[model samples]
Target: MSDDVTAAADAVRHGEVVVYPTETVYGMGADATNPDAVERVFDTKGRDRDKPLSAGFPSVDAALEYVVTTDLEVAFMRRFLPGPVTVVVERRDALPDVLVAGRDRVGVRVPDHDLACDFFERADTPVTATSANRSGTGSITNPSQLSDDVREAVAVVLDGGTTPGTESTVVDPGRGIIHRRGAMADDIETWLAEHADSEPDA
Candidate 1:
């Protein structure tokens, strides 16, 4: 497992796409900061070029570095992140257009899984957090769940066993919006209500 993680990190560093496990599901990623590498992810997943890709960071602080946030939101991140929520916030220009899709906002994640984040940290780059599946298909939870096309498209698949099968709940705290409700919606709502100065718009 350790050797595989090392190889995966190396692969990412060299601009190769790799399939890795996240707490929510398996993700097909490459260095999010690398435009060519990020393009590979979009190509592999058959993802829409205009659709933005979320980023997975090694830690909460690292993830926060790419987005605009307030103290209350940072507290929310500290509390629920490294878990199963993707926080959407104002994007920083440091992120490439491929990841942000020319938008001013981007979704960010700090995966709770140790192996995945270790790979990200070792690679020393943020990774695209899009699911390892063809567009419009269900996410891959295990290697066997990968389609033939998807299986053939990647250079490595780090089988971290079966994932939790629920995609992360996506929230835009600045707008008080829940973009997608999944594994952690209720908990996030409660936390936001307790911490946010005003209620979320949605």
Candidate 2:
């Protein structure tokens, strides 16, 4: 691993936040299971406490450790994960309530970026997967665009050049709902419609 990636991972394990690149955009990361670390993310971004943050893992299999997934959800993950998509599913007790905002469900992200996955794997835990920007502000595509507040709040910044800058599509496959339409919306919608019959009754 590169020195920057290793530092970022170490910061996360030490309950500090870091900024890292993702396939969609730059993301603010902290140990998702740590309530204090998660609170720091919300505070740093001035984000509403009720607004839940997604947890990022190195892979779908790693994410499965923190979320409860049905067969349909598993199929959906297999089809679109390691891409720009946030799959919402039930959270395991291992996740802090702060991360999910006291909600039963949480968003799971497996970014299709080598740096991100490497950081997650080295961190050895799920990390907060929210954009690396203050709430209500634009998402960041490059480390150069990161605000002073965000930069100062984070312990490390892993610059992986520029990112695609699009937000990931957020969907609840079990409920067959698309909470937010973003990258690959059309393809995701098509997949959902074609697999609607397989979704568990809501």
Candidate 3:
């Protein structure tokens, strides 16, 4: 592993936060299973407690460990993950309740960024996937884009050059809904239509 990843991973394991790149944008992440660390992420962003954070994994299979999914939902995930998509699913209790704000569903992502994935793998923990910016503010696409406040809050900021500058498309495959559109909205919608049988209970 790279020294930067080692440092970032160590920070995460020690319940500290880091600003790291994702395929879509830079993310401010802390260990998802650590309620205090996760809380810090919310505090840093000025995000509401009611607005739960997403969990990021190294791969779709890793995400599935914490997110309950049907075969159809798994198929849906296999189709667009490791890309810019946030797939919300039934929470499996593998993560802290704080991550989902006591909700039974959680948003999860398998970002297609090697450095970010390697960091998560070394940290050996799921990470909160909220963008590295104040809530309701624009995302930071590069380390230089971070505000002074944001920069000062994190233990480390790994610069992986500029990102795509878009947020991940948030979708609930279980509900057959596109909760928020971003990077791959059309692709997600099309997949949902093709797998209408997997729709969640109304």
Candidate 4:
């Protein structure tokens, strides 16, 4: 692992927030199981406490350790994960309520970025997967674009050049709902419709 990844993982383990690159955009990450660390992510971004953050993992199998997924949800994850998509699924108790805003389900992100995956694996814990920007501001594509407040709040910043900048498509496969129409909306919609009958009633 790179020195930066090791340091970032250590910071996360110590309940500090960090900024890292993702396939879609730059993301603010913290240990998802730590309520205080997760709250720091929201505070740093000026995000509403009511809004939930996604749990990031290195792979679908890694995510399975912290979320409860049905066969359909697992299929959906295998199809679109490691891409620009956030799959909403039931959260395991290990994931603190603060990360999900007291909701039963949480968004799961497996970013298709080498640096991000490496960080998650090295961290050996789920990290908050929200954009690295203040709430209501444009998502960050580069570390240079990060605001002073965000940059100062984070303990580490992993600059992976520039990212795609588009946000991930947030989908609830079990409920057949596409909360945010982003990256691959049409394809996700098509998949949802095709497997509508197979999904458990929401």
Q: Return the TM-score for each candidate structure.
A: 0.94, 0.98, 0.95, 0.97
Candidate number with greatest TM-score: 2
Residue 111 of candidate 2: its Cα lDDT? 92
Q: What C-alpha lDDT do the candidate models reach, one value each?
A: 0.86, 0.94, 0.88, 0.94
Which 10-residue span in candidate 3 carries the lowest summed lDDT? 193-202
Pull out the clashing pairs in model 3.
Answer: none
Q: Which portions of model 1 miss their true places by more than 4 Å? A: 196-202
* Residue 182 C-alpha lDDT in model 1: 94
* Residue 17 Cα positional deviation in candidate 2, in Å, after optimal superposition: 0.2
Model 3 Cα lDDT, one tens digit per residue, 5-39: 99999999999999999989999999999999999
State in Å the error of residue 108, model 2.
Answer: 0.4
- Deviation in angstroms for 122 in model 3? 0.8
User: What tens-digit string does per-residue lDDT give for candidate 4 at 115-184?
Assistant: 9999999999999999999999999998999999998899999989999888899999999999999999
lDDT of 2 by residue, 139-202 (tens): 9999999999999999999989999888999999999999999999999999999999976644
Rank by TM-score, highest first. 2, 4, 3, 1
Ranked by lDDT, top first: 2, 4, 3, 1
Cα lDDT, model 2, residue 199? 61
- The backbone clash count of each candidate, in order, is 0, 0, 0, 0
